[model samples]
Target chain A: AQTVTQSQPEMSVQEAETVTLSCTYDTSESDYYLFWYKQPPSRQMILVIRQEAYKQQNATENRFSVNFQKAAKSFSLKISDSQLGDAAMYFCAYRKQYGNKLVFGAGTILRVKS
Target chain B: EAGVAQSPRYKIIEKRQSVAFWCNPISGHATLYWYQQILGQGPKLLIQFQNNGVVDDSQLPKDRFSAERLKGVDSTLKIQPAKLEDSAVYLCASSLDSGRLTDTQYFGPGTRLTVL
Candidate 1:
């Protein structure tokens, strides 16, 4: 079984500042995928970013990026210039390269302060 | 494009009662997923389907829980003789194609179930 861990239970960041959420996983598969999802008060699970284990280059979106270290089994999410809208519950997920199911971490609640 | 759609955004039932939630995936999406999310916890996959065919359902409690995706589009999840611990948010998600490495899932608003 694969397990994902998010050590931080809650995190706070001032608006316009940067915040990083930590995540780690245990998997024996060589090829896999890592993801970060955000769930706001609306209860919608939104995809923030994703990284493929085979690719060493990190994945970056408009304001979100991921630091994926396959060897260390760590995948962290970085939010730049955070906004009030960024406040939500962030989750780290893992999926085998050829697998269908996704395993998720407990989750980290992020609060953006004005 | 329209996102995944889930009906009855909220439901309240008593223990040992039965409840069902409905989900309609995006048009042309071949893969659909159902997840259970408790308060303060991340969403957990309960079942997965590909074009009305079961792809994975190992985590589902078959004795009390059941789900089906008929005609490769809409899906339904039912909990029979529900337990108090079954209170949670049920989410539905869909992907264009599970075989594609870049396929990202789009989620619905989720149905919040409260069992007393």
Candidate 2:
């Protein structure tokens, strides 16, 4: 069984500032994938970013980036130039390389202040 | 591309009642997934399917929950004698690969279920 954990229950960041959310997971599989999903008040789950376990270089999408530490089983999301649109509940997800099930963390509510 | 589609955006039912939700995955996607998202929590995988065959249903509360994907294009989830804790949003997602390595999954808006 795979489990994802997000330590931060809620996070606040000023507009144009930066913020990072922490995530950790327990997985016995050597190959897997990680993802970050954002859900706003509209209640739609949207993909934010993804990281492959085999890749040493972190993944970056425009203003979003991730620090993935495979050995430590740690993956974190970083938002630069944070904007109001970033305000939402963020989730850390894990999936085995050979299975289709995705294990998700509880989620961290992010508030972007102006 | 059209994202996954789910019907009955909202549903309210009393305890012990039965309800069903529908989902249409992205065209050509072989893998379909159903998830339960409780308020203030992340989505939990309830089931997974490859084409018309079920891949996994370990976390599904089978005592009252049932799901089917007849032709693999669209699927339906049902709950019988709903429990109060079943109050949550049911989400549907689709991926290009049936295997777990797919990093991208398109999700639907989800059907919010309320059991009173």
User: What does candidate 1's lDDT look like per residue over A1-114, in tens digits?
Assistant: 899999999999999999999999999999999999999989898989989999999999999999888889999999999999999999999998886678999999999999
True contacts kept of 2: 0.89
TM-score of each: 0.98, 0.96
Clashing residue pairs in candidate 1 (N, C-alpha, C atoms within 3 angstroms): none
Q: Candidate 2's residue-wise lDDT over B1-116, tens digit each?
A: 78889999999999999999999998999999999999877899899998998889988999999999998789999999899999999999999876445547889999999999
Please give, for residues A11-106, the per-residue lDDT of candidate 2 as tens digits.
999999999999999999888889999988877789999888999999999999999999999999999999999999999999888776778999
Q: What is the interface RMSD of each candidate, in Å?
A: 1.1, 1.5
DockQ of each: 0.81, 0.77
Off by over 4 Å in 1: none
**Model 2 misplacement above 4 A:** none
